[model samples]
Target chain A: MSPRLYVDFVRRLGNMTLQVRLAIDTEILVLFGPSGAGKTQTLQAIAGLATPDSGLISLDDTIFFQRVPGKPVINLPARRRRIGYVFQQYALFPHMNALENVAFPLAGRRDARERAMELLERMHLAYLAHRMPHELSGGQQQRVAIARALATEPRVLLFDESFSALDRPIRERLHEEIRALQAEHRLIVVYVTHNLDDAFAVGHRLAVIRDGRIEQIGRIDDVFIRPANQRVLDILGIPNAIRARVVEVGPSGALLDWDGVALEAPLLNAPPGAQVMAYIRPEDIRLIYPDRPLSRIVGTNHLDATVVERRMGRHVHRLRVALPDGRQIEAVYPASSYATMSLAPGERVRLALRKESIVVIAVHSDPPPIEEEPRLDRAKCADGCPKSDPAPVSPSPS
Target chain B: MNWPAFWLSLQVTAVASVIILVIGLACALLLVRVHFPLKILVETAIMLPLVLPPSVIGYYLLLAFGRGSPLFEWFNLRILFTWQAAVAASVVVGLPLMVQSSRAALANVDPVLENAARTLGASEVRIFWRITLPLARRGILAGMILGSARALGEFGATLMITGNIPGRTQTLPVAIYDAVQAQRYADAHLMVLVMTALAFAGLLLARQLEPPTPGRRADQSAKASV
Candidate 1:
């Protein structure tokens, strides 16, 4: 059986109390949050660098840290934990060359040097084994640090924003490499990154942490498409969170009454007259082309809107549109489409919102945002939304 | 030129410098890495000799190691008016320089690197030996050189505690004072020149161990030419 890392702890840090609980298996679980969200602290706790006030942390059958009021405290020292951690700064020993650094933890082993060289080769850093940390580039140094961390054959590998400092291409390549490494070793990995792209590129599951607490944890697509609470929605930075009420529900779907505008959304378990927040991404709002056939845009909630404002982004143009009710909604169009359509302020256009694109989150209950059932109304959504693909309404870049 | 005094000063300073390095580093490590109550009080006590007059320090050491003090009464260490007393005075005067410099050097070593070593499965002893010591070597060396220089030039404290016993307790500085008192201008001038030259050499060595600055990189690279 594959190993599992279970962490449940509460630690008071000055004014902030970090109470975290997680169970990670062989797959990578990305801890996603803003800065100071206790993601690094969680990693520290797991690595045995930080002791918790009172809780139990275990990996498989081994107890890593345990502190109960009446029981004998069992806090393992960091050196004994056998967990690998790659810090943001790499923290390579400035004086030691790459080979020596990797060989440091292998002191008692007879084949320490050979094993370290092999680890370097595994990281594709064999040629730079003699180089000091300052002589290597950031990514090269990072790889050396990884090689050093792997020398001990740790049970779990924790990376704290390890790729945020690299260029986009290098970062993406490393993301792929880490995924391959995790699979090859079958090691449980926990990655902490505040960057959304980093989280998506490397994570098999995502845990959204906020204010020292996990707001939601689920498969990446589920959390993005159907956030459990207002906090999770806000952290995802979804641009449109419109106040609405559930007006009607059927096997087909639920009808949401936004400020004087009715929007068709995925089937919700919520009752009618319940206050809800309908979250829609700007890219999800599609502009209906008059020249295209109506069949292509069928089953979408169609609305007449006048462009109140337009702003140019690097690749997309953001159009702030006003419904006949005077309520404004933001939609994004590709620069190519905006240019071809010659869209401008004060121009009247039709917008289409796929029912699957709208996520209706209840304002109250504020329950944990995991284990949400499939909210997709398959019968009505099968044609417009692909079950596996998230953000189905947004056109693929290719 | 008071050759015996010159030799005695070298012996006292060498012995004192070695003791200072060991104790100073231990104190420095404690100050930088440990957390305990009254830490500020300990730090102030260590630094007191740096600012206090050598005579006042001598007075305190006298009482502590004097006739009725615990060190003398219990251990019966009759070090007064001996070369050992001169060594003690040199150590007392030189220790503050060593501790302050070593503390700064140890503090400058990034704690993050130590934590990284800890996570990498290195014990505290290994981390100190492999990581902390090497990284802080330059500053610590500089501190040792400075402390040695201070010990070599020690006159006031040695005079108060050991008295000016020619060919025994009289260090170079004290010997120079004795020569000038007897109106031996030539002997005083020669001893003074020797002391100044030794101090200058020590200071230059200490300066060489200083961390390189941006403006000095070109100079260092030229010197290294590696």
Candidate 2:
């Protein structure tokens, strides 16, 4: 099928306004972002639930909204559009049975009951046809929602934090179910999620949104590997960032004086005398002993550091290394490597970064803002004084 | 028994209750769903009839339909002092009750249900009819019954709009007033008995829709919330 699903619009939430220019017809485009990112806002705009201030939204050849020099009218109510929106809450009608809720749109029509029963059967909710939404489990409700949306066979499907409500195992199984459903229906799915694992699992393409803009939109692996800026590198959970300067530039790649390690980074277009910060994913960095050949052969951007902290996660050990310059960088090694290295906190080690793995960004950065002011506390005289108990006071006359 | 006045009162209350129910529900839907520039002002306006005294409400209706008024020509359309005038009075008194109860009912509905209904391809009108109207049926019933009871209790507004014209304007309330003035104690007592029975029935209906108090049953709340 031709690429007909396209969304070009601008919408606002709070003080932040999101402007999205996108075109996707047959792919599962997962909007990846932190909470309060414009991921869900963009989907709401496409669904016509949230109106854009000015812009055009076109799905296929039909124009849903437009703002131009001569023409100014640009609004469409949600019903006029044929988007199947699955709310974060399944939102099943409480009064109706599972079958009746599934067949609700078909109500007031001939054969509505039979059609509803058919839909419920597909969702494996036929047995629960007489049951209300509260009677069903979280996973069952999700299936019912999916079945209801597909009842009309809509062109595009929008899921806003849909699986975030379910239990973990159920969430995983639902992903497979959704994928199978998407393949069978060939429907264009625009899923908005804050979970990285879910985005990578189901998304054909990932759009990372930050501060009301599309920071980067590309294939999932590409965005994860090469984030465009420091903000994205930090947002995507990259652990190690080191300050460096450009020493050599080339057409093939540039040599970075990354903390005096002469790192052969495959990024360029920077003048030789520029100060940069290289971002590296922790998984790429290897913790090697001083005697290793790889540690000895390092020329560009290598750090002789001592491990200051070790954290054991589900699948890997997170080691925090403090370089000689008093800057810390983190690296993740397989759990198996833990036995060989005999690594522990405060042990000295050598760290290495792959030439292509280091993403060098320009120097200026803004620190996160503090929302609340700091208050000074006086000495406390009682037990449970400072930790558990707050400041005790006599009642002021009301 | 004064069957004519009894039947006339029932008819006026039923017809007026129907009109108030429809208009009040429409206003409630507007207040709940649509966002207008003067939303607060419109809400205050819809509820204005509630707080206004029956005498003040009658005075305003009389002015609009009274002779020597601009709209008096339309009064020549046979509304003033007719049985239709009693229905009009009922409409005035019944409006606030209808609007308030319907708004409460509509407000209780989960927005998710409406959104889900829309995405499932049901039109806006269909969602209201099938999903909203049905779910709020008990509230709607209570609102109408309250309006009916209010119309039954109407005295000042009815007297001002439609003077006591027996078999036409002499509803049970109006008839009772006329009986007491003429020193017909037995007649007034009989009308009182009938009015009390009807009032009790309305109270029964209103009680049926008592809106289930908070935290009693989750199922009841879900049903009420649509």
Candidate 3:
């Protein structure tokens, strides 16, 4: 059986409380969340850098931390935990050369040089071994940090927004490198990032955190395609999350009244008259030319929409289209398609919301308004309609 | 010049700076790294010498190590009015500068870097020697310069505890006072020149011992990499 790390802890972080519970085996799990959402704190607790008020953290049989009320606390020091951590800034020893930094953990060994050289070579940093941290570029420094972290051959590795500092090209390359390293070492990796793209690119599983709580955790596809609640949908950065009401339910799926425009969704667990939220990926919503044949339509749910706005992106075109009820839905199409269609604002178009792709999330009673609603509305719509997505979104899944 | 006083002053300054460096570094590490109750009070006490009058420090030292004190009675240790007392006085007046400068240097070192070392399986002691010490070397050397200068010129405190005894307890500053009081103008002038020359040489030597600034090396490598 693969070794698993179990963490269940609560901590008070200066006017906020952090509570997290999760289990991770030998796989890459990305703690995805916004800034200050307690993702880093969770990693610190596991690494024994930050002690929790009460809880248990163990890897396989070795207990790293355990605090039961009215009982002895078993808290291990950070050095004894043997957990590798790659800090956000890399934090390479500025005084040491790349080789010395990688060899730090093996300080008293007879063959520390050879072992350090092997690790540096594995990171493709052998030629730059003598270079100091600030002398190297950001990407090089990050590689040295990783090599140093892995020098002890730790059971688990944690990265705290480690890749968020690199350029896209370098980041993508390192993502592939890290995945390869994980497979070779069979190390359980936990990466924290606020970027959806980085999370998807590097993670096998996704755990979305909000306000120090784990909002959702599952396989990447499971969590992204079938979020557990409306809160999960919001944290997932889905722009077209619409509050809808279930009008009918059947074995196939649920018929949802999305702002009076009826739409079909995959199998839902909610009953009729229950309020729910429908999330649709911009790429999943296809733009149908006005004169296209009826038999050529791809989805069951069709709605007439007027293009309210069109924004050009690098590889895709974002279009905000309005339904008959004045609610806006943002959709994206490949730039190649946009070159041919050249759809403009105020142009009437037909939109097909793929039933299989629409994630219907059950809404909690007295739900708080989404955080970006006010800013999103003030940016696009002047009438105070709650619309999401002022920030640039991920490119369409190609 | 009083050759005996010159030799005695050199010995005292050297001994005192060495002790100051060790104790000041320990105190600095405690202030920067460890957490305990009454930490602020401890820091304030360490810094007392920086603000207190030299005579006041001499009074406290007398109470602790003078005749009839516990140290003198129980251990039969007689430190008062000896060259060791001069060394002790120099250390007391020079320690605050060393601690203050070293604390600033150590505090400037990023805690994140130390945490990174801890995760890499390094003990606290190893992290200090390998990571913290090397990074803060320049600032610490600067502190040494300040401390040694203060020790070399220490007069008020040295006079209070170890009275001016030529060829025994009198340091160069006290030697100069003796020369001027006896109206030996030429002798005082020569000794003052020697004092100024020694201070300047010490400053130059510290600068020479320091490694090249990382900023310059980094800039060169950055260009090379580009």
Could you give candidate 1's per-residue lDDT for residues A1-398 as a string of tens digits?
Answer: 77999999999987589889998888889999887788888988999888888899999988999997898889889999999989887788888899998998899999999999999999999999999888999899889989998998997999988877798768767877897898799888999987776776677788999889999988765677568898897787766767677788889898988867788887766668766655666777777777866655335789999998999988777899988888777887676664456567888988888676686533322333455421222222222332223344355321
User: How do the residues A1-398 of candidate 3 rate in per-residue lDDT, one tens digit apiece?
Assistant: 88899999999988679999999988889999887788888998999888999999999999999998886899999999999999887788888899999999988899999999999999999999999887899999999999999999998999888877799779878887888898899889999888876775678778999889999998764576578998887888787766778788899987988766888887666667766655676777776655656443355788888989999988678899988778888887777673556578888888877775476543322333453211111111112112232433333322
> By summed lDDT, which 10 consecutive residues of candidate 3 chain A come out lowest?
A373-382
Evaluate model 1 with DockQ and give the value: 0.25
Interface RMSD values, listed in order for every candidate: 9.4, 5.9, 6.8
Which of candidates 1 and 3 reaches a greater TM-score?
Answer: 1
Clashing residue pairs in candidate 3, if any? none
Give the least accurate 10-residue stretch of model 2 chain A, judged by summed lDDT: A375-384
Candidate 2 per-residue lDDT, tens place, A255-316, comes to 77765567777656556766555566566666555555553323344668888899987756
Q: Assess each prediction's global lDDT (C-alpha) against the native.
A: 0.81, 0.72, 0.80
Docking class of 2: acceptable
**Positional deviation of residue A333's Cα in model 2 after best superposition, in angstroms:** 18
What TM-score results for chain B in every one of the models? Answer: 0.91, 0.88, 0.86
lDDT score for residue A108 of model 1: 93
- Candidate 1 chain B lowest-lDDT run of ten: B217-226
* lDDT (tens digit, per residue) of candidate 3 on B1-226: 8888899999999999999999989899899889999999999998888788888988998888987899999998798899999899888888887888778778777777888898998888888888789877776777777788788988888888887888888889889988999999999999999999998887786666444533222222111110
DockQ of model 2 vs. true complex: 0.24
